[model samples]
Target: MPPYPTGSWMPVALSADLPAGTVMPAQSPAGPVALWRTRSGRAAAFADRCPHRGMRLSHGFVRGETLACIYHGWSYAEAGNCQRIPAHPALTPPDTIRVATQHVEDGGGIIWISVGEPAAGPPRFEGLAPLRSMVAEAGIAALEAAAGTKAAGGLLDYTHDDRAVQLLLAPDGQARTLMHVLVDEDSNPDERIAASRAAEALRRAAEDIARAGIAR
Candidate 1:
């Protein structure tokens, strides 16, 4: 993760978490978003609630390139236009029947959703590969205390056993964070495991710091 202007890109998910032809709910500054990927592996984000009956679009199913509302079976194209209405198959759904879409970008094993119109793209963690993501039950300050260092530009570099792990942070509402763990792509399995434990330890430390409100 890299810091950007208030209205900018937010790395909400990893590419592996959102497989093609699946949808998941994610949070953004604007609110919750229905993040989905087509069978062709193209990712898109839309307002989580369906305009038809207020059902969550994330609970809907994806067929081909369209997302169908689970409640009413209304199908929406990738562009968010209503393409089919099961109730009135012969009738054309009005153009007004559409879900709001957000700009999405996928690269470096991360999915970046726009908070607004970002004048830039997501950061590229060169030579590093995303390992896993975990939610920290604390704020950035707590995380800093846990790691014994403050993150710069939303990335905290933790070096242990001569191996460095990079953390990409995304704030979720308040008193919580989403951290994407990244390590060198060619790291050995043992090293990857160590990195994972290191992250867990850091999380514990951060949570403790938060609970105690004491700097360590």
Candidate 2:
């Protein structure tokens, strides 16, 4: 079986973690990506590299609707077009000076980035609230061993201490996983806390399995 689902909209981050007018580092099947939301609360994803001097745009800061490179202050609009060059304030940047962008969807409290030209929108899990996200230093096989079952559609159903939750996972490179925890929408505060703790324990268990060189 495949490690996890691929070639569709991938859950990259929780919407709550990314406030408006902020930029964050993310991943894509193509390469590293820069995910950001504008001051108007529009989300956009771009190839992380700056077209001007090869700087990582994730390190850049958001200014209004544009994300500006931290190195030379080259500003790119939400459409990935270079709008301003600080060094040449009077010159308008050419349209060719643009950063590559990808399709983004923010729904069901998650930020989903399309892997390619997907034909459909992201899948939604009704009545699920995102709890938290963390990286596990383990591959999918190790995680499957820890959870006692394999993932389906990039989701794994896990329960601990009679508390059940869903884990949305995406491969972070070769041997790491980006996991997002989700609890029932109506779950109370105490239950949310418990779910978070259970997810942490699962992460530790998976890591241990990976370190022991155990393959599922």
lDDT (0-100) at residue 17 of candidate 1? 100
Tens digits of lDDT, candidate 1, 1-216: 225356677889999999999999887777898999998889998899889899999999898898888999988887899999998989998899899998999999999987678778877888899999999999877787777777887788876556667888888767888888998899999989999988888888888888887453
lDDT tens digits by residue: candidate 2, 92-196? 999999999988999989999887677788999998988899999998777888998878888999887787878999888878889999999999999989999
- Minimal lDDT window, size 10, model 1: 1-10
Per-candidate RMSD vs. true structure? 2.5, 1.9
Clashing pairs in 1: none
Index of the highest-lDDT prediction: 2
- Measured against the true structure, the TM-scores of the candidates, in listed sequence, are 0.92, 0.95
